[model samples]
Target: MRGGPYLLLLVAGTLGVGRGLDGQLGSPCHPSGRCNVRFSECQDNICRCSGTGVPSAYNNRCLPVADGLKGYCEENVQCTVPHSHCRRFSKECECVEGYVMARDRSVCLPVSRLGEPCLERAQCKESTECSPSLGVCVCRGISYEYDGKCVTDHISNNWELTVVTVSPAAGSQLLAHNRWLLCIALAALVHAGVR
Candidate 1:
C-alpha cells in the first residue's frame, strides 16, 4: 500500500510535467487544421479562432497573404502593391496621396490631370475638380485656362490683387477711396524700391 501511494504521486507529477512540456513544444497551429493567418491558435484541444485581426469572411478558414493593391493585410510588409499602404483599421491596402485606386482595385495610378477622365475627386490632382456630368477633371474658379489645362492665375502669373472692402459703419465713401489710394501708393513705393 505504501508503494502504491508513492507510485500514484509519481504518476501525477509526470503527467503535470508532460503538460508543461506540451505547452512549450505545441504549435499554435496544427497540421490539416484550418486557421486564419497568424490570427488563430489551437486551444484546449480544439482549433479556436478570433476575429480581432481576421476579417469575417476569412475567420473560418486560413487565407493566404494578399498580393495586390487594396488587398487584405495585417501589416505594411505583407502588402505587395506598389505605392500602397496598409490601413490597419480596414485591414486592407490603399493608395498613397496623389494617387487613386484603380478600377479593378489592383494597383495605384497617378491622379488625373486637368481634362482627364475621373471617377472620384481623389482621382484628380489638388485644386482640380472631377466633373460628374462631364466625366472628366476640370479646374475652375480664378484658374486661368491654358493649353488644354488650367493653371493657378495668381501663382502662374506671378501677381495677385487683394480687394479690400471697407465697412460703411467704419468709413464714408471718401475715406474708403483715400484708403485705396494709400494702398496703391504703398504698392508703388514697394515696386519702385522706395520702401
Candidate 2:
C-alpha cells in the first residue's frame, strides 16, 4: 500500500489520527481498506486514531506520543503529579520544576519562584521554602532574596549583588575631605564679612 497524503497531530487525551493507503483523516476509503496500523485503521470509510496512538505530523504513519506530549498542569509544569517530570519516549504527567501539587493534590501550582504564596516547602522553588510566618516563598539558609530571585551571597550570572565595603583608610580620607570643604566654606564666609 502507498502512504497517505496528510499529517496528523495527536493532542492530549484525544485519539487524533487517520491514515490509509491513500486515505487521510476524513478522506474516502474502501470497505476493505488496503492499509492498517495500530494508531489508525479503516473505519466507516474514514481513517481514525485511537488511545495512545498518534499519527506522524511529518509523515503518513502512526506513531506513539513521545516526550513531546505536553504536560497538563498550570505554570508549564511538565507532569500530572507533583515534583515529577516527563519520562523519555513516553507521555507522563509531570509538574514543572519549582512547583508542587496543591494542598488537595488536585493540581500543580508554581510555588517555587520567590514571592509566590506557598503552603509548604515542597511547593516553593529550589533553594527556597514557604515561610510559615510570612506565608510566602523565601530564600533558604544563606541564600537571600534579590530582584525576585533567590541567590547566594556571591551570586553570579549577571545577577550578582554588589556589596559596598570601605576600609578605615577610605573612611578617614572621606572625613578629611569633608572637613577641608567645611573649612574652605568658613574662610569664604569670613572674607565676605570683612569686605
Candidate 3:
C-alpha cells in the first residue's frame, strides 16, 4: 500500500514463496528489512507478519486481517465479529465469554446446552459445558444429554432452543456433531490466517 503499482510488480519478482513474491507472507527473507512485505519482518529466521497479517495454523501463509472470527489481531479493537473480541492467546477474533460462533458462522450468540455448538466451556449454559472432543454443548452434573436441551429427569426445561424428542432426530445429530467439529477446525486454521 505504500508504493505505486510498479513497486508491487518489482517486489513480486522475488522468488521462492507466495507467487514468487518477496515479502509475501511466510516467505523466507533476510534480517535486513525488506520493503516488499508490509507490517512484516524477518524473525526466528522466517518472514513473519505482524498486526493484520495473520499466519496460518501451520504457519505457512499470511492473510490480510479482517473483522471476521478468523481475523488476526492483538487487541479487541481489531475484530468486529458480533459479540466477539480478540483472544490474547490465539491472537484471533473469538466470541466473548458466555458466547460462541453461531452454526452459520455469521455472529456470536449465547451458548446453550444439549448439542448447541460451542468453542469453550464458559459459552455453555448453566449445568452444561462445551465438550472438547465433540465440540458441542453437553450436559454437566447429573443431567442427561437428550435432544437439544439437557434434562434432569428427562423433563424439558422448556428452553426456547430448537428441541428434538424423537430417536431419529437425535440420530441425525450424530453427523451434525462431526460437521461442527470440522467447522471448528477449519475456523481455527482460517483464524490463524490461512484464509
Of 1 and 3, which scores higher on TM-score?
A: 1
Ranked by lDDT from best down, the candidates are 3, 1, 2
lDDT digits (tens) for residues 1-195 of candidate 1: 779999998987655441222332232444344333345555553444343332224334334456677677776655657888788799888888778887788778778988888887768875677888998888866675576677654332544445678688655765665887777757755654554
lDDT of each: 0.62, 0.56, 0.65
Model 3 collision count: 0
TM, every model: 0.35, 0.36, 0.30
lDDT of 2 at 129: 85
Give candidate 2's root-mean-square deviation (CA, Å): 15.8
Candidate 3 Cα outliers beyond 4 Å, as residue runs: 1-67, 113-149, 152-195
Task: Give the alpha carbon lDDT tens digit for every residue of 1-195 in model 2.
Answer: 233322222242123223354444444445565335456756686666556555554335555443322443222223324455554454454555555656655566775558878777777766888899998888999888777777764323433233458799986786687988656555555544522
Reference-based lDDT, residue 149, model 2: 74
Comparing 2 and 3 on TM-score, the stronger one: 2
2 against 3, candidate with superior lDDT: 3
Model 1: what TM-score? 0.35
Best by TM-score, which number? 2
Model 3: per-residue Cα lDDT over 65-174, one tens digit each: 66588667866655757688888898988888877786666678786666877776766876787888999878887877666656675433332233456588766786
Off by over 4 Å in 1: 1-73, 77-83, 87-92, 101-110, 152-195
